[model samples]
Target chain A: MARVFMKGTEAIAEAAVRTGCRFFAGYPITPQNEIPEYFSRRLPEVGGVFVQGESEVASVSMVYGAASGGTRSMTSSSSPGISLKSEGISYCAAARIPMVYVNVSRGGPGVGSIQPAQMDYLQATKASGNGGFRMRVFAPASVQEAVDMTYKAFDVADQYRRPVLILIDGVVGTMMEPVELPPMKSDEEVAAMKEAKKAWTLTGHKLDYAHRAWIQPGNWSTKVMQSDSEEDAALYKSWQKEAEAEEFMLDDAEVVLTGYGISARIGKSAVKILRAEGIKAGLIRAKTVYPFPYEAYDHINYKKVKGILDIEMSIPALFVEDVQVAVKDRAPISTCLCSGGNIMTREAVLTAARKIMEAK
Target chain B: MELIYSRTKTIQEDKVSGFCPGCMHGTVMKLIGEVIDELGIIEKTACVLGIGCCGLQMDYMAYDNATAPHGRACAVATGLKRTNPDTLVFTYQGDGDLASIGLAETMSAANRGENITVIFINNGIYGMTGGQMAPTTLVGMKASTAPFGRNAKDHGYPMHMCEILNQLTAPAYLVRTSCNNPQNVMKTKNAIKKAFKNQLEGKGFSMVEIVTSCPTNWGLDPLKCLDYIEEKMLPEYPLGVIRDR
Candidate 1:
């Protein structure tokens, strides 16, 4: 496949379609509007359905419904919109419905800035909804990576019978880059995929009470709830092996910089500049934030590394908490942060690195 | 001996009704089961059940069903119906679920002319949550939340879901019926059947708003609740089709 220049959100939408996603329900939000817009135009071409729901709440609920019917379904929103969708997302998780959703994140605590920001790190990975359920959270730094992750997310979602989150910032969502699109799944393949879910999916049941399909988000019986939670705990624990991060030039480095999504992309540039200036700097960019690549931090040479600098566009620095858990006092950690949609600058990252170096 | 009537296979044979005495949900569920059986859609029918007393039917319903989040049954049905058009989809919702918390979803789905049926139970009070005031709770009707009776000054008048949905341009059918008496119960069943038939014909959005009673919540015996429906509920929500097309 030839690489073609495409915006991040558009490429993600096209990738989902090629991956056999036939149903999408979403409400419009900033920095991510191109996602639904692209799906609206492209889905019909492939016999897929696109619905702009009345609100984010309804949109996620719609995806839950569609996915329960054995369709590859998805929804997308930004920070506040994702907050509105948490309840439905939790329902999907509880019901063990396989679906995908994207969050083109922006600054937020309330209705925050519309520009690109990495303010939803904790929300996406830790507290997506009422239940303490975990989702495989993917943070893509470029359009090509976004395409690849979005394409593979459906398989992972189906395999785990859970929702997957593609977490990108406004920068990655709106930026344009050349991406190699995957081959579109044939209609037969799509139908077969749905057919594979017949055992669990709700396509209606004959008077076969023993094999009836019932999609309940909650169990009314205490015994069933307890057993389900125990099973879920084991499922979440098994994800430790799936934790992934891009460890760049960490060997013999003095300062290690870390972040995810656009902030990490900027941090990588700062690492290169610091290395050119004879400062042994490296980068650890998390690809999956959930099972937060703690093992990658363990591989760092604590004897040589002076400190770690956490780079993010969130002023309060939500991502640093995970970095702290990963590093675990092996090296002193510092942060370079901004908020309210202000993009993280490579200069700020370098300055922070230099300050960390000077402190020792 | 030839059998005149028996339980529909759509209802689980062994499961006993969980509904309170004088509550009309069991009767309505039986009517729906009969409709499903008569239409021969038992194998391809999927129901989205709302929260509140409506959700209790999940255990008794033998057909495929999804228990939607509170007030989200219509939205869920929209997704299910759109993605699997061959499958028959409907939402079973209560007054608080459809008219209050889920009003946006119900109205939006209806407005979009989604080819799905909605079975709205307007029982005037919230049954599952211990008789709280519902959007359809009649003015001057006492509730747990509105102890002084739903005064017009404080609490608004009862909402007529059929009339409200009839104002929309897309709904194919909107009817209000009740299950207070044998005659009215038969009428409610006919209306439900019509609503389901409309969905099968691809006629967009049909809703049968059944004006029912919650005897436990209404502080009345089952017999008196029937009288209340005839004397009070009917005057506010008249039985008959509000829209056919």
Candidate 2:
């Protein structure tokens, strides 16, 4: 594939159109608004439905209804807008509706700022809804990955019968990088995707004349209905194992650093700097945050590894908690956090790792 | 023996409704379903249900359906109809869902004359959320939230949604009928059929505000519920065609 330079938002929108997405509904918000604007002009040319909804709530529901009708649907929003769509996302999860959601996070506790920050780590990974239903989250670091993650999000959503989110921070969302998009599927492939909906859609119940009678259930019954089969339960159980991450320079190390999203990109530079100082340090970057990839910790020898540094750009040390939980009995963990728009640099992470190593 | 019943002609049987027993929602659903069947547009029809007892209409009917959030059926229907212009779109809402929380959405859609049908069911109380006072709850009517009755000094009088809707020139057909008695049931059916017919004729936004009963929430039996809707609610919200533009 010939790689071409593109922004993260553009890649996601283009990849969506490539991967059977025929309906795009969204409201304009910072970091993610570019996606809707890009699709608004391009989607119509391909005979796709693109609607700029009146509100985030309506935008998410538009995707919900369109997906319910057996069309591939998607929507995008930033922090505050994503907060507004939580109710709709919950409903889609409860109904096991297959849809894609792209969240280009910016600094926020409330109307915080539009600059790059990892403030939404907790919101994107946990308590996404009233129910503790887990939404599959993909944290892409670069523009190319953002586009590739969106194209793959639909496949994962369909395969699991659940909602998948592309959780990108403002740094990746706005930055332009090299990307090579695969050729869009032919008409036959698009038709096959629609035809494939029969395996799990509730479009209609085929009945005969002899079975025409109806028995009405109570209102409470609708709440208790079990739409997922035994096979679905088994597939859901294996999702955690299939999730992935990226590892660099972990084989011979005395200290390890863990991060994700834009922070991981910074972590790579820090790893090189620490290696130049003749310190044994490595980096473990997570690609899938929801699955948490617990097995990655087993590769590091806790006895030899003195400590771990978890760096993020959020208040209250959100991502570090995950790192602590993953390496519970193994080593001491420290956090590098920023509340507003201050992103941690390569020098900052390396300095934090050096402090941990010197303390040991 | 004519034996002329064919599965109510419109609704699918297995879905089995979730509305309370003796509730008027069932009658309203059947009427809408029959009208869809009569027009031969079931496949191309899409219904939007708001959050209320009446919104359970989606469970009873088999057309392309969507259950919208509280006060959002009209808004969602706007999107549904605009995207699939060939599909027949309608929004089903109750007094609370349509008149109170969703008032903005309902009025705006009506004002836009967005070619869609809205089956506004005025049951006087929020039945789904435990009988809270709705915007259309009659003054002096006691609900869970309005225990001392909806006071003119405090809560004000019940809103006449049909009259409010009639003020807009966009709606080509707007009628207020009841399902209180056999005679009124026939009138409600005719009103609904006409709403669908208006769409077939490309006549813009049509709505039929059906005066119905919520027996469980009203602290009345099925028969008394019917009597209350006919006597108390109807006198204040005079039953008639508010608009036939």
Candidate 3:
């Protein structure tokens, strides 16, 4: 597997196409624009369909429709555009239609800025839409991770018959890096992906009303709705076992720092600098945000640990809330946060860790 | 025993389209069923349902169908048709859903010349909700939202979908017909068959705009609603072929 240098957005698009995704529908937005642009040219070359939808609302609806037709489908956008797609994504969740989408996040509350930010942590992990539906959200720290996670997302989506989201930030979405791309799916395999899911997908098959796929129990039946909700709850609980986190330099540490996505990348570098200074610092980065990977906190050497610092690129520190819950107040937590297009800095994490250590 | 007529096997048994008693949605659904049977494409046809009164067709129609979010049937149909090129894909939408909220998707899909069929059901008001004003609501028509009547200046003008679509070069067929009477019903069915046939031939974008009535919302009996459609709706949305290429 020879590594090739590619932009994060382009690699993500190519990786998805290689993973049996043949239907691409998206609306252009900053930080994630290269994704749709690459698909526009690449998908047509592979006997696939690419639609630059009229709006984010229509783009996700197109994904829902394509997925319903049993095709491996996907969509991508930035924070603001994903906000518009929330409704259709929820429809996929309720229907248990397997599909993939990506949110290359930018600073936002309302189109706040187009620069790098992790402000969408809560939106992507918690309440995605009007319906209380949960999606498996993967946060990748580098361009290579972006490519790998995107390639793996489709399989997971189909396995669970649910939507999966690749949560990245502007830096990782646009930066170029050497990534070993996955093998492309041949035409036969693409068709087979659809054929395999035909038992439930709406592929012009004979009408099977009594056993058809639905979003919310068709024709308004309260009993069916309740049963469907219970089923979804069980599926959500099962994801706890799939949660993953990467632990770095944790043994014999006096202070630890935690982050994810691009924030985690910055925090890792900060830990190395602190260790060189003999500060005994370590890092724990969550790869799956929704399942949260609370077990990772148990690795902390509590007797030697002074306190943990939660750092990110968003103000009001949304990701920190989950960090607090995961740590369960075992250690006092301090926050180092920024927002509105400010990048999370390694210096900031190191400074915060020093403050926590000096306080002890 | 002698058989005069028989319903098509494509439609599910006793799956009466939960439409209002006088609504023409069921009759139109039956006509579509007949067309599917006539063309022998029932095994490869998919319907995309838009929200509104017409959205109910998803439940009763026997052929495979997916309900799109409100106002996005055309986009959904576009994706489905492109992904499964051999399959017959069509969208069933209402006035408010297609003309107002989904105007962008409808126009873009048609302009792109997507190989899909669209069945637009215009009944002047939003029938699913309490009689609210729609994009096709007639001038001086009183609606729950437009209590003082839809004045041209204040409420803008009623949207003529077929007329607007006719201007686009991509559509192989764009026609508006009625189902208020037996004679008009036959004409509407012919238009539907034409639209479907065009899709089978790989023609780009075909639409059959049927001007039906919402008696439940129109505050009239089913009989008078027919007359209202004939007298009021027809004049505003004159029934005829707007385009064919």
Candidate 4:
């Protein structure tokens, strides 16, 4: 298929449909509203269900319910809305329901602003909900990455039987870029997909006692709940093999700039400027924030590296906390950060990298 | 005497429900069981269970069910019904779960006319988290949160879900029934059956708000709870079909 110029939000909506998402329920929030708007127009053409949920709470819960019935379900929201959905997301995690949710994050400590920010990295990766269940969080830096990631999210969700989150900031979510959309699934393929879930989905089928996924907590004995937790813990542990990151220009670089989503995109531009000036600045863009891509830091030559510069669109730097963990104090950690809708500019990244050398 | 009807084949016999003794919640669950059985859709039914004591119905309601987090079962039912419209879907929620935290979800599901049934149990107080005042708690009702009785100035008047839902034109069937008395219980069973039948008929949204008893939470015994409903609850949430299209 030929690439088309489309807004990032529309590309995500169409990509979700192409990946066999037949049901979408979402509440409108800025920086992510285009997703539902596009779905309302596009889904009906494909025999898919589109619901503008009254609130994010209802939207995520709808996704949970639809997913339980073996539908390829999805919901999306920004920071404030995602907070409301944390309950249903945790429920999906507990029930081990497979679904995809997108967080086109905006500036927020409390409805802070509608502009882009990476303040939600910790929320997406770590404390997604009350329970310790982890999510497969994809932080796409570009519209192309958003399309590819959103398209592939469904399969990853089904493969792991968990909610996969596409954590893009307002920047990539609203940006227009050429993206090669994946082939759409035929109605027959959608039906077959539902049929494949008959074994575990909440169909009116006569289920035997061994049908684990269909049982709710009300029906679950304490023993069953404990065992399910243990099994899921093992499953989370097994995800390390699937953790991913993109390390750029890091063979012998002394300063590695680390960021994700739009910050990482700017960090790359900053790296290019640094390289042109004959300064060694590499970039490590975290594609999956949950897995942390800790191994990427291991690839860096410790002897050649002076410090890890974390660029974030946040106050006091949130993602830098994870960077601290990955590098483990092997090198000093510095941050170039802003907050309250202040985006991380490439010039800011270069300035921070230069300051790291000045302080050393 | 040969038993003309024993128990609904749809409900499990051996499973112990967590409802407190004398709670009308058991009666509501029985109605659900009987409705599913009489319709011959026991094997083709799925339930979304809301939080609170209402959730324990999944233990004995042998049909497949998903226990949603507090205030989310109706939204969950929307997903379930749309994903598999062939199966009859319903959500069982308590007053606190549905009318309080999940009011928007309940309304949206009804307004969208999603082909799912919602069985709302409006007891005057929150049963799961103790006797906290609920949105449907009467003005004069006493609860843990409303220590001095629900004063209208401080706490708003009880919300009539049936009346509010009736305002939404999308609803195929909306009714306020009860489990307080045998006659009312029978009416509730009939209302539930209608809601289920509507979904099977591919009609839009339907809900049965069954005014139920929370004896333990209401500071009333089993007997007083019935009296409380017949007196205080029924006057506010009158029993009868509000809408049946």
lDDT of 2 at A61: 72
Candidate 4 residue lDDT tens string, A1-360: 997999988899999999899899998889888999999998899888888778888889889988998989999999999999998888888878999999998888789799988788789999888878898999999888998999889999998889999999888999899988889888898889888887778887553333423545323478877788888888888887778888999998899999888898899998889989888889898998977788898988889888899888988689988888889989988888888787777778888898876674
Better of 2 and 3 by DockQ: 3
* True-vs-predicted CA distance for residue A93, candidate 1, Å: 0.4
Best lDDT goes to which candidate? 1
- Mark the 10 consecutive residues where model 3 chain B has the least summed lDDT: B55-64
Taking chain A of candidate 4, what TM-score results?
Answer: 0.96
Q: Could you tell me the TM-score of chain A in candidate 2?
A: 0.92
Chain B TM-score (model 4 vs. true structure): 0.97
Better of 1 and 2 by TM-score: 1
Scored by DockQ, the top model is 1
Across A180-219, the per-residue lDDT of candidate 1 in tens digits comes to 9999999999999999998778798788888889998998
List model 4 lDDT by residue over B1-245, tens digit each: 88787876666767777779998878887788888777888668888888888887766677888888788887888878877889888889999999998888888888989999999988878987889999999998889999989999988899998889988989999898888778888888898898988999999899899888887878789998888889888888888888989
Please write out the lDDT profile of model 3 over residues A205-319, one tens digit for every residue.
6555565433331436878788888888999999999999999999887888999998888999999899899999999999999888898999999888999888889998998
The residue pairs found clashing in candidate 1 are: none
Which residue pairs in candidate 4 collide? none
Off by over 4 Å in 4: A207-224, A357-360, B1-3
RMSD of 4: 2.1
What is the Cα-based lDDT of residue B99 in candidate 1?
A: 95
Query: Candidate 3 versus the native: TM-score?
Result: 0.98
Deviation from native of the Cα of residue A80 in model 2, angstroms: 2.0
- What does candidate 2's lDDT look like per residue over A1-360, in tens digits? 788888889888999999988888899888777899999998887778887777787778777766655668899999989998887787777767789998888889898888888888888888776666787899998887888888899998887767899998888998898898967866678667766874333233232222321111112454444433343455556778966788888888788888899998898788888999999998888899987777787788777898888889887778887887888768888887776878777778878889988893
Task: Mark the regions of model 3 whose C-alpha exceeds 4 Å error after superposition.
Answer: A207-219
